[model samples]
Target: MDTNGMDRRQFIKVSAAATAAATAGVEGILAARQAPAFAQGTALGMLRWNDFVPASDELLKKTIIPEAEKALGAKITLETVNANDIQPRVTAAVQSKSGPDMIMTLNNWPQLYEESVVDVSDVAEELAKKQGGIYEQSRAVAQSGKKWLAVPWAIVGLTIAYRKSLFEEVGYSKFPETWEQYRDAGKKLKAKGFPIGQTLGHTFGDAPAFSYPYLWSWGGKEVEKDGKKVVLSSKETLESVKFMVAFWKEAHDEGGLAWDDSNNNRAFLSGTICATLNGASIYIESLRKPDQYKTAKGAQMRTDIAHAALPKGPAGQFAFHVPFSHMVMGYSKNQKAAKELLRYLGSKEVFDKWFVSQKGFAVGPTRDWEKHALWKEDAVMLPFKDAARLGRAPGYAGPAGKKAAEVLTKYIITDMYAKAVQGMSAEDAVKWAHGEIQKIYG
Candidate 1:
């Protein structure tokens, strides 16, 4: 919803003269205006990241398959194939035409898989028709040259979480507005001898979420203009890296580098960090536990935390947002049936069961559904809903975006960010990183 605080420097430097994001946005809008409804059919086959387990099998038995049967007189049988990697899962499925009819994709996956997946623009058109005004950022995700490749299912938005009791104890008057203010708040707390604890580890999916906000907020663009290049090495990128290193030193404990995905949870719960980087799911978990927040396990004993928009930098504030992009593949035996399944999943009835009843497996990237009874009092998910309003997908979009981030992870971001938090200058680590990305993307 809010594309605020995006880094525009590296993108400017690397400009082919046209920005990929801007163009992508334009194309998607245009498609939404013109795409026709695809015809519906019968029982469709599906392939998902989770072939037989949590991401897929569990989803089908509990939500999708039953919903589809009810909506389209269709039954979906799933095929399990381990994606060579996330990017390949969609592309190879489209290119080879050997898998199931539908796919469960990451929000940005459609960009790369568009060439092979079915034209999903109509699904989104239906969403807009249903909601009056669809969340615009979601349009960015579904856009390709002339069609939408994915349907938004779930959103993972980020927010700042800090201990309210700690802030009160530190004599803080109010929450910080921009990232700088937030940083200063952390500094003040540290000055008072309370360490703001956080983690920077080689943990699952942490580095990108922790730092992407800064890069984006610093105004860094993932690709150069002219829609033809990547900007992982631009000045905006350099500055973003610089900011993280500074933030890490100032806010994180000395052992922050040793922290893992569960570290922030453990630390904030233990009152180790004054404020921590976390998601709505944390609060949701807390609410479910109830006593954890009230007892030695409660939000106070656990961390009487509150959520804030990620802090703003000199350029702009930022945070990582992950959205689930769902789609039916081109090879689905039941093409129309697959589309019907998609439609049913996005409807009011199924959404309740999938998102709330099943606990966010079918997520909403936009807050249009915020009024749903489930999220209103969801102590944790409500903030996530707020964060979703400001969320943005990965910089590397579609095939190129997904593929490049992979390169960034294998070559730069993963171990590089891990090491940078350990005292390496981010620039130095990224020097090796940018070089690594060049080799892979080029």
Candidate 2:
């Protein structure tokens, strides 16, 4: 899913240090002695996804933006669209050279647009030094070599949100810990009319979040460590695809093939599906409207929901979290204002408001957030606390760069599984995906 405080004396000391650091040449510093001067009607355009947790978006629009505008002395317009549609908007902006001055990007997209973005090394490094360092997973997608193509934002950790009662009713007292066990449990659940929910569509978030980790857990990868050699057509990949074909037939909601990232969330909330691999948004939504979402037995669905990490496979458990970052577009005329806005929004005080609104659907890019007291508020959210530590970026065993971004944007891995589930032979699906990836890598 796309999911803080300080003492007064300590805050003052930190603010003073930040002011000093701002004078030391950092381009974007929120704690500057005074907001930088700009044209009387300076304005910046920001494009972001319609966040899964609606409250987070609401927080941005109602609270954060006004505060930012007053603090930075610029008019800010926030535009949001579905996550799947973000890439096309980014592509359009890069091509037209005039669009939102700041664009929020997911996964390795910053890498795909590396040459079209301004280096925010000072902004990123400053954030890292102040907060605990950015997690390596977040850093991988935002940093190219030593340059910061984008400033790290947040990581939306995807987990298997399941019904505790449903798993127990299927004779599994605990959530299944391995793929075979999960499949076995899912088979029984489907027989009882509560199948698992998942998507294999060309979604930007949940589709890759599931597909990449599933591939890696079975020892399949799109490329080798050198990041050039295509090696996806392996015995392991074919085996995983073949297994998925049967698993889907036996255990999943068949309607998932056309579902987007939001579909599984809806399915789970409406009590139609027993479990889904998703961000904490599903559970968070239920919390937001406790009386609206209910279990089949007429109980609050929030009480029934619990989350587990993705089941382990032969190689090991893995995760492909959706890491988000803000890119200062190279074509932007409001570069100074946009960078200042990034600095403003990314500050701990401001980000905490948005983070609390998410209620654990999205975690901060830095390690400091894991230590936040909010994780202790809900046991169901604990699994996501350390999720970034276990995360593997796209193009596993290789750099998550432009080629990996191309493969991801193309939905190569996701289609590999979808094709098999739709009746293509597993070998053929694997071969098709391998060929597609080779076209990118070559």
Candidate 3:
């Protein structure tokens, strides 16, 4: 908790400019000098969710685009489109080869643009070499067969949010540290008519946050590297799944099984449930936006609620982050310009605005930003920060990974996994889900 390492934003300015300059000096400026000939203005057709971090044009000009253009020597213009409907536009644009110069979003976009998208592998490697390894969990996401697609969009930020005053009302000066203690606290909350809002609906929100940490704490894993073979089905994973299902009925609302990711956020915001699960940033932003939080019974909060990392599971405490990064197109007319842009974006100086998002600072999945000036010495970050240390991203990165999640959600969402969780017999639920994947995937 020290204002130690470079305030990530400051580091970005100095690092990005310096790195861009070095590229010009070391690689020569042919691309820099040539980009303007083909591209006349800074016009980029971009698509993304509504509230993306670094989504502002001000940040784009100061933090991202300036450094990138300085190095690439071409002007870029950005066009924004709503994510809910942008897929079709992006598809048409890219297929027609008239898409924006750059596009940003989750790495798991349906149809990847290896040709249109810039490959930022070099940028990612540069960051890793400069920083003491850019967190393996995230690095894994950037790399594709030795080619890198992304650099982290700042730091991984999946963290828990909780009601602070609620903890105090429960007669505890502090919250419990271990899983057992957490369950006991839940019992206490139930005694007070504030039981946790449980779920089985959506994987991106409560389902994933609630499950992956369970696996990490128990030392469970979704896959194992067996020499050249990637093994998906494993005992550790089975145990983790079974354990997660056990909480489906206990922790969720009566309609929890039919809920989706947004359900938890709505549940918590509405105060229908004392605590649910969600991302650290979303939780913070929710507190700031009254519109984002509504009552379970449809009332809105007159005051802000609080959030922290969910309590540790039986295995151990852990966090779940969406490890995101940027990648470049292999077939770009401006490969050199694209790569330079990639380097500039990854440079700490260029991406600093991401840390100052209305939500909270995003550091390495585990690095503590609580002590930083940006956080202003806020202690509420402690638990969330602690959760980051051992957290895991749900396997949503690769094609196989996405398919796997779909498979799980399809079967598990309907209380299928609940049977196993409730001790209705693990072999059936476990084997059904696992065997189904093996057949389809194999």
Measured over all alpha carbons after superposition, the RMSD of each candidate to the real structure, in angstroms, is 13.4, 6.7, 9.1
Q: Give TM per candidate.
A: 0.72, 0.92, 0.71
Which portions of model 2 miss their true places by more than 4 Å? 1-21, 24-33
**C-alpha lDDT of residue 425 in model 2:** 94
Sorted on lDDT, highest at the top, how do the candidates line up?
Answer: 2, 1, 3
* Candidate 1, lDDT over the whole model: 0.58
Ranking by TM-score: 2, 1, 3
At residue 266, give the lDDT of candidate 2: 88
Give the number of the best model, judged by lDDT: 2
Q: Write the per-residue lDDT of candidate 3 for residues 19-109, one digit (tens) a residue.
A: 5456553133323322322243433333334444434445664655654555555665555554444446656767777655455544234
Tens-digit lDDT track for model 1 on 288-385? 56565552334344346577676676666655565556777767666655665666667655555556553432346555666666656546445655
Residue-pair clashes, model 3: 33
lDDT of each: 0.58, 0.89, 0.51
Candidate 3 has a TM-score of 0.71
Which is the winner by TM-score between candidate 1 and candidate 3?
A: 1
Q: How far in Å is the alpha carbon of 74 misplaced in model 2?
A: 1.9
Model 3 poorest 10 in a row by lDDT: 29-38
